[model samples]
Target: MNWDDMRVFLATARAESLTAARGTLRLDPATIARRITRLEEAAGAALFLKSPQGYRLTEAGLRLLAHAEEAETALSRGIGALSGSAEQLGGTIRIGAPDGCATYLLPQVCARIAEAHPDLDLQILALPRIVNLSRREADLAITVSRPKTDRLHGERLSDYKLSLAASRAFLAAHGVPKSVSDLKDMRMIGYIPDMIFDAELDYLSALGVTRVPLASTSVSVQLQMARAGGGLAVVHDFALPTAPELTRVLPGDVALTRTFWLTTHAGPKDARLDRITGLLRDGIRDEIARLEAMPVARNP
Candidate 1:
């Protein structure tokens, strides 16, 4: 019945741990426990079933979740309406993105956003796995592939290119691949076949590479290996600046392109969401142009 109690209940339910809820609410563990007890007493039902794994919602808790979310949304909207301007908007925005993009691109974009809105908290989850927007895994997701579900909204963020590349040291020792056929002789770095999270990431196949001697689920790891003279890797052009010692291999001959899709849950409109989306969209567009203009040296 109490909004404060519902807020505590929602935080605990979502986090599933008293410690996590404590951090989220900035309340002591004892206070959180007392709040949960009060909420359960007020509702006249046990809201959660505790186990070693953490809190599991009871049937009653599951029933209350939908209404709780509605109330939460209403509160967010009310707050946004009172904020009066996009610049005044403040809250956490969790963005899920591919590891490569997260490492090479998002930091600058996030910094720019922070510079403009100091109150906004931006959380970027740069994992190789997919983010489930429907489950509230992330407030926004920058994905290599688009979702097929109707419950989400998505837009093409940008089409970026990838190419085979290796460190100057690696080429000096092992030789550079001159053509697609030459790639067969070189040690290749790429995503682990079985661990490929998205089809768009299975880039080795596009270059006629059926096998990679060095593989990892993390694009950043592949880049590091390639930079260490381990092997040639199929890497995003946007990521090239990070390793200046590396050079593009068979640039024009072996190019792979993929689009990044911006996805979010299909829910009520919010000014904050629109502002952040615009920031990302514009940032990516500018970065894509910069990537395209980067000079690639051909094997002589």
Candidate 2:
């Protein structure tokens, strides 16, 4: 009997209806029925009992089911093993990362790969939602938190420092506060409602400052608000220096921080991914050093 027929038998047997099997397989119902008929004729026994409810599997069908599942599993594993044998680092590597990570980190990584391995293909999925590596949704990932699953290989890449900042125009109009207590009277741009635990909130809360309830979910919007001289926001040091008008508030001692991580699945070795991770680490390290070295206005 054909393995194709056997696979159809398993599908039809499990689904209990040719219509359902067709839907699951995305094939026509007649095609599924034809395959079932072929399988039953080869077996010389009825595989299912038709009823008003659905097709119920016969004892013969159940017996074949065990073998069919085993065969399918073995076939899948064999295919995976075969693919893993390739030593070339040229296939598409699906990578997922947060928004800023994609914007700040990937360009440099892509440049490095282009210089070294031009044939390598990279597909990046940039979203705030973390995709599952265990489910094969992504081949590699970079996240703020290390995944707890044993199926992943997670690593802490580095920790980043954050500070509260605003445009000089905003500070001038809003009247710069000299003390942490003075923060209550000042207008402040806050994290979006859902992002109350973000760096901005943490920094304000740590200083015993009362945050203004106005919040924007988008990081880009928050930056824009600060840039428009609307209010103060907690921006990462790397981001702050890029804004010509933005200046650090309480520069000497800020409590906001976040950690960066590099993570991947435990797959066969890939030189492209290894080289990409190395570039990302170097870029982040360089940025951190640059931010730390820049002097900010001291609260005198």
Per-prediction TM-score to the true structure, in the order listed: 0.82, 0.63
TM-score of 2: 0.63
Q: Write one digit per residue (lDDT tens) for candidate 1, span 85-171.
A: 655647888999989888888888888888888888999998879987654668889999888887688898999988788988889
Tens digits of per-residue lDDT for model 2 on 19-113?
87776578797788777787889999988887768788899888887677667556644654554355443556677876555665566666665
Q: Tally clashing residue pairs in candidate 2.
A: 0
Worst 10 residues of 1 by lDDT: 80-89
Q: After superposition, how far is residue 150 of candidate 1 from its true place, in Å?
A: 4.7
* lDDT measured at residue 17 in model 1 versus the true structure, 0 to 100: 84
Candidate 1 global lDDT: 0.83
Error of 2 at 115 (Å): 3.8
